[model samples]
Target chain A: MSRNIRILGTGKYLPSKIVTSEELDRKLGLKEGWAAKKSGVKIRHVVDGEVNSDMAVKAIEQALKNANMTKEDLHCIISTSASFDQPLPCQASLIKEKMVFKNHPIPAFDIDSTCLGFVVGLDTISYLVEAERYKNVVIVSSEISSLAINPNQHESYTLFGDGACAVIISKSSKEETSSIKTSLIETYPEGVHMTEVRGGGSILHSRHYSEKNKTEYLFDMDGRAIFRLSSRLINGFMERLFKDSGLTIQDIDMVIPHQASAMAMKLMRKKLDVPEEKFMSIIENHGNVISASIPMALHEAIVQNRIKRGDKVLLLGTSAGLSLGGLVFEY
Target chain B: MSRNIRILGTGKYLPSKIVTSEELDRKLGLKEGWAAKKSGVKIRHVVDGEVNSDMAVKAIEQALKNANMTKEDLHCIISTSASFDQPLPCQASLIKEKMVFKNHPIPAFDIDSTCLGFVVGLDTISYLVEAERYKNVVIVSSEISSLAINPNQHESYTLFGDGACAVIISKSSKEETSSIKTSLIETYPEGVHMTEVRGGGSILHSRHYSEKNKTEYLFDMDGRAIFRLSSRLINGFMERLFKDSGLTIQDIDMVIPHQASAMAMKLMRKKLDVPEEKFMSIIENHGNVISASIPMALHEAIVQNRIKRGDKVLLLGTSAGLSLGGLVFEY
Candidate 1:
């Protein structure tokens, strides 16, 4: 029943428009160094004309190329995102359309668990591959954080960027396989309101939507509250994860934690007690791309030689579900 | 590698507000009998104050009760829907919150493929169960289509109803396994535009939402186009499905297909050569409940004593992915 679902390739796409912390501060009318000092984000990508699926398609294409495979090789496409280009048809379908995989009609869908989307997708696909239901499954986490963040919300506006990450998952050959050791996802719905877009759903139906209070539809985050709540359980959660996986912190090569915020990441790293050097951080340049953050960081770590073959990497993050999830694998 | 995933129980929730076609026709300023004659929907449930998660939780509770289980028995909760009460915390998370399952902290997420949402979830949970990842998973499809239908778009408005359907999937005992014979989902991204709500996603950013194109945010359907596109493939798709499952059309006791529309249902039944008695239809009483249509129909069939323990049942549907999917199993 256990099988190694290998990560064949990883790829990411960042927008062209780069917004520095100082620029964001100016836009939000905040003190000059307040933005950068509060959040470690120096510069982040902001989309202008591109959409969520556009970025996802680009990342997926790169993943396919990196895996040295073509569209024909993929048996399924799973898109993970909190920021959708549209609510209907699912973003995966849009990505499939944009990618021009018309000849290959695969099962495509979107899984949303807020920021833990990528990990949720990874966990789900790992099982699918393990079950031998699919051979080559493409998983993409794409986000347009800029579209969701309210500019008036100074704290959130300066800490979000638009980006996407994609990975191709398949059963490894007998000679080489990345053993996905353990995958765990737990959600405490009590934390659902820590981060939310109240007006963006059926609650704010189009029939009742008013131009007034338009900003309510944008993303809202109680950073301090989330940090306080998540920090309390993170240590215990990490312990459970390590215990369940039967691996100690010392066995991990690197930890790819969600770049939630500059402060949150620092605190989590300290609490998890992973060596500073062993933690992969990308928020300084990419800010928080929500679901894409983990995969984007993982992709960068591999490219920068922080993770290599035979390395044990743990992907971790907290999501809007008040969810904490991790995927431990040998790279 | 293949194993049976038994459906332990089935449940459905329909809003109390029943709007007859004549009432809808009057409200939409259409001629009497025009609405019912066109879509053959005599009545459909419309939510007054309840949201997607509200209905979903009710259905799930009923399902659990029907299965003679408690919340403690569920290892995971997967929700399927194109309509969300909100976009941030995933409907499954919201359901968890509303259902008072915060104590369990199980993995929760949402999968969306428009109307194919339920089928996709079924395919997914089956693999997960077959892989022994989870013992009992609750899959619910809750949709408030009444919130999305454009009153101005007569065709769509008359065809949608707010409802939810839930089922408990678990490992079947050796003596009672309801073998899931075949589960196939194919999405032709080419049809992503056939049915959609363009205004709810990043495409229609909240910041730029205009009241002028207000109706654009509601569900829009090109029924003729979807019928034409789906008709060309349903026969072939069903043939392939029967072939792969090692079954035949004659072997199936009943088919619970998505109640897309009365016209689409009749045409599909004729084209697929499924006898009128063999095709389970509920559009007249429930309309098209989007993702909940198939499950709701199946639940109704079970309640009406149409599906017995040893009968072969086929769940089929075409969704916004312009996707056609089918899952065959023995009750």
Candidate 2:
């Protein structure tokens, strides 16, 4: 656990097109407002013409500006995405190509924990920063999940969006109090197949595709199964996380949970007993952006002054691994 | 840069079926021995009905047995795969499920650097082991790349095999000399598209599949482009790597290079001036197993007793990112 790393800046990028739930209701032939009522998503961003890496680069540029740093200052780029830009070369390499830092062969790679990518990236890279191997690093979670949405899977169809969120982080000075308290990510494989895309991998090669198996290539989820498994484990997972750092839920000044869904968020917040004002929510407009959810919500919280420097903040999320991840840090 | 981490054990698993070049000659209607002459592959393994994670778990089980430990001893599972089991929950989660270790909520994730995945996985996880965050970590690189090879593309079709390689690594005590001397991974994004699967991603969603764009779904490569770019950079890259570690190639007792292609391996070995006796080669039988190559080669080298404990070892490779990685560690 690296205790002296700090997040210098944060930024997010959402695709231009917005699809309101009412529009989805009309498109899917559901009753008016039914889509919004079912998914609790009012308007969610969707990509009309943008590619994933281009959107990731835009978010990186914004983060660079926020941190008052340029691409030249970065020691490495860790791209975190549940959905990738391409199937080969890894996502960070594609992002690095788009950044076009002519002579900088900055070390880059991908760390994916599905929706928990951003949190895991932070935890993994903090050790490197603490070791002083990388002085400044950019961790970006970018997802073009809308492409994986199967229109026929009505439950998940209206509950997703496309976006990218980025953060520039560096080693804090000895005098600065900025640091991560602790973070834990635990995968309970009991729910491994609870959410998945069955095609496009070795088990079911995408080239074998035909109209008969289109759903296999798209995102499929048993939302109730995930919620049931996660709810059964969330209490113990969080208890272990806080106990590891010797901190409690009350020590957290703000709770930044993955905006999985409006209902899921509300339920988790109430279950955790975090005050309403302290819990962050972006799902109403952003939908569940997969890995980008937590970071995007954190970016919004920072922009809105909900979390300040030295404030104790906690990021919590349940990802497709049926993974539970929580991180408590000082902003 | 973690100096005291030691590889406790290593293992590899090749699928049951071996496709010989002679068989390919008959199958593809090419001249006898033409496939062998061109691809330099005698025989290669291909999965019949096995899933990627099952192969990985088998390899991990072998590695654990070699280490005199069990799955219960693992602190984390870091799965490295250029090709995945599935696109959703990640390869690690799937591997965990198959391990079936009840009550062990192992923290798991996926790290993909294309063919360089094994080297990158080791480098990244070394930090965690050094920090004592994880006492024992299993890093496995599994690839079922034969599924991605398009028989229509003669070059890549003859060049790939499928296999899994695994190693258990832990912290070395004060008396042990086992340590990583130095490692450097530099990604020159200039050649991002030199090799790729342009489909099954946001850019060309697999759902948009059709016979017209079928080629996009399979592995496509401009071999000359990658070789040309890599050759221009390898000397400087190796020079910097040895310079950083304050050691020359002469100090290394064994050299393990990625089984990219027999020609690539030969050219790289000759260019680096490594004696044939000290260089490791397994491409003849295994073919270019993508991400599983280096680790698979390393496992073979150790099994053959060509390198003893405490000997200096170097693992080097180039992947789809046009990324060059070099690691000199004490075995």
Candidate 3:
């Protein structure tokens, strides 16, 4: 029998600070409705003094509660994030420590793939669980993109929020109720340079900083190019995913794309010919939470009764690495 | 029948610039033999203008040649590293562009767990291959640790080197003479703070350049604590590994430990009761290459005829994440 990795629980945490597009426009000297109409974003949540680990912990706590699981039940914890609290020990270690799971000594670490990180991590967990190497896995996607955004940089500052989401994947042999039925990950390296953070990291250290040289270490992006690429890749990936799984678009009850720009999501919907009701998006309120976008949206969708048990949900994401991935799950 | 993931090819790339411990001492005000006697590091490579992607491309090129495979043969490429060029798009995507493979798009991304990255990456690939999700996989572990080192910080400066290693894994069911037998990964979150880079990440980004900042965002380590933890974990893991594999120490031909420090290796060897001749240390020439250390040493061992075609080689590593992992492979 083929072992299936099922998501037993799902949870998300978004900071309470809400900044409206008008407020952002006034703060950054932009025209009214510019942020909303251009990106389909009305507001975004910004965390106060909340790091990636903090957000991840919140999400994980809620997820465990929902799953009725203790830390000891987890065999592995894989946390994915673009923003890290430290460069040496991964952010997951911090979460492991804070949660006081030290006694279990569960293997935990951070996985990164920009915005597609969570999907990749989820797939990795699925593989491990199916191989019987791990019984219970906790995959957390958390980001404090606001910390990397330069408030002075109008483009990125208005487009990123702070949030985290967690999914508890368990090994199961049942056919119909499995959480992750199938997953596909694909990368288009040619589009990597279109979006990125130019500074920071070992490539550009703080020691290289000079009083006169105020480098923009903040997130930098080519909005127009990303839009075009996102539309093409998102649609292409969805088509291939459905085909590979021997399913049709009509079989998918919900589509959760990365909560990046409102325009990109709309473009994807139009290109894929999927109805707006079939798509779930949280970008209007949360902006781009990077890896956390899809799962966070899933959490909201579940809460709002947009999805029900046995629903086939397509979780898709695309990011600066010019990377894209999707997972079809029966929830 | 269980499918096995076999290493079809292996390749490594060292920067052209080599710096002897004496040379590094002259530049950093350290004793000449301190690195060699204490850390078993005689010389280490340094990348000048080249970055992680450059080394990755070079290693992947050689790996392809050795495997007699083109980029199209690969279904997935997983890059593992601690020192990345940027925080977005992932280093794997950059390497994918260089290959320019014409076929179905291959999934690629980066995995980080400090020095244990390579072992964990291989384990992940093994699980994915066994699941029959991917047929051909390439795992690369590369680091530009020098980029993170503060030349003036004598402690971290003496311990790091830049290098890259790549291994191509493919699905094989043949009864091979030697192959990746088994592997185990463990993480001790309580010990994460024993060694770390205090700056450049989200935690210190705010106070990175502040005068009040005591930690310089450079690599900081509590060597004594790490020694204790390393010895305990490495010894304990090897015991369990050997028992699980039903192999004795005498059956193992060679033991390759992460090229961290000579003292740690010696202590571990003593605890494990392994003969000195059965162990190999490349730190004498490569220092601590972090994630790249084991593969680089394995490559050197293979070239030097220290390991035979069917030799049982044990690879182990531990790092700042307080993470440790091991793999048993047939040479």
Candidate 4:
């Protein structure tokens, strides 16, 4: 019999500073309720000095504690983050060093799939465990979206928050009691340009930077295009995921779409014909944490008693790579 | 029974411009044979206007052609590159958009494990195929190391290159014979800082750029430290890989270590007690293409008849992520 990889625990960490619509409106000269109504974000967490790795460490610690596992028990550590502290050592290496796992010698690295990174990491870990290459893996998705956000760019600034989420996945002998039974992934490259950080990579190195091009260094977004694509793709991906898993929407006790915008989630709910109660949304408190959004939502759902043992949960996410993915798990 | 993932084809592309040691010595006021003796590189391919994505496209196209499979046949595309065109909308997405795949909508994204990226990507594809999640997967590793090179720094500039390499992996079936079998991945985050690009990421964005700190933006290396780690780890990894595969080093037809430096490979060969004739080196022509080195070496071996169908091949690589991995395959 084939072994199954399961999510043993979930954890999330959000910045303490919460920026309300009124505060942002005052700072950005926007009308009250405008940001709230359009993005369905009354407030969003923003990191002060904390970096992506810092947030990831917090989430991983919580996840390990919840799983009753220690760093020594981990065979792999896969971190996914778009806003990295550095380009050379990889954010994963930094986390490994900071956590002092030098003697453990476990393989740790980072995966970049834009916003769908966490799901991709999760899927990759599941594959490894199923292949019997590893016994335990820790997947962390951390993003300080606020660092990339252009304060002057209202569209992006009001929509992003700083946060991270993580889950410990391990090989389980009790196949019937596992969380993640299967995962399906899909991507559409046509939507790649809908959202992006226009600078800071090899494409726009420091040599190209000038005072006149300050705006180009910050995150940019085609809000309308992303919203339209997200609404269409999320529904299509969820449907395909259900078909792939041989499970119907009715079988899912909860649906956690990436918390990009409240409008996008509502549209997905309507398309999937699932009630709002079945869908979990953390946008009001954390905004869109990119790759961490779904896991953050899942963590919240579990704490709120929205998910229980044997309950089927569906996770769907989409991002700048025009990437979309879904995973089904029974907790 | 477990499924086996095998390599279907391999292809590589090098930049058109080649910088000979004579020219480099004159430019840097270095003694003749200095670079050749230190890094074993006599000439290095340098990118002109071409970027990582461009080279990857060429390799991917050739790999598909070699496999007699259309882009539509691929279910996933994973590109590994240290030099990315942008921070968002990963380089992998660009390839998916440019490649006409008969509307199959294959999932594509980037994975960054530095020099070990290609091996990591191959391992990922193996797991995906083993889980029956994907039938046809393409792994591409391309790097334009010149973009990160500090031309004034002769210590590092003369020992790098620009190139891309790709491999098509598929699930082995009764109708199709296996070529390359399985891969092993190991990472040592403790060694991450042995080589790195100190600037241009989120930690020190363009906002911090200054002429006085120009060197900060270029790739830096602790050559001696990396040499020590590479030599030690490559041999250890190879031994474990052969043991896991139930094979002996004498059974391998070729060894393709990352073309970081010739001395590193020589030391590793000595440690493994492998014959010089069984190992391949491309640093003499292409320098260190970072993530692209291993595949570029493998491509050359295949072209030179050093590797053949059912011949066991070993790939070992180490990079800034302080990430190191090894894979054993029968091709």
Number of colliding residue pairs in each model = 0, 0, 3, 4
Residue-wise lDDT of candidate 3 within B113-199, one digit each (tens)? 788888888877777786678888888887887766666556567777899999888766667655677777778876889877767
- Candidate 2 chain A weakest lDDT stretch, 10 residues: A1-10
Chain A vs. true chain A, TM-score per model, equals: 0.97, 0.98, 0.93, 0.94
What are the per-residue Cα lDDT tens digits for candidate 1 across B1-331?
A: 3467788888899989999999988888888899999988999999999999999999998999989999889999999888999878788988999889636878889888789898889888788787778889999999997877878778888888889999999877888858788777888876789898888777886455566877667788899999998988787788767775778878999999999999989988888788998999999999999999999999999889998998999999999977888988888
Give the alpha carbon lDDT tens digit for every residue of B1-331 in model 4. Answer: 1236677888888888988888888777888778677778888888788767788889998998888887778889998887777777777987777675554667887777888888887776676786667888889988877777887767678888888899888878766555445465666766777788877665677678898887788888887887777666766666666664667778878889888777777877788888989989878888888888898898899888888877878887777867777777766
Local distance difference test, each candidate: 0.87, 0.89, 0.78, 0.78
Worst 10 residues of 3 chain A by lDDT: A207-216
Give the per-residue lDDT digits (tens) of candidate 1, residues A118-217: 9998888778787777899999998997877887778888888899999999987788867888777889877888899888677886445566777678
Better of 2 and 3 by DockQ: 2
For residue B77, give model 3's deviation from the true position in Å. 1.4
Q: Which of the predicted structures, 1 or 3, would earn the higher lDDT when compared with the native?
A: 1
Candidate 2 lDDT? 0.89
Query: Candidate 2 on B200-273: residue-level lDDT in tens?
Result: 88888877778898888889888778888988999999998887677899999999999888888888888889
CAPRI band for model 4: medium
Which stretches in model 2 have alpha-carbon errors above 4 Å? none
Backbone clash pairs for candidate 1 read: none
TM-score of 3: 0.95
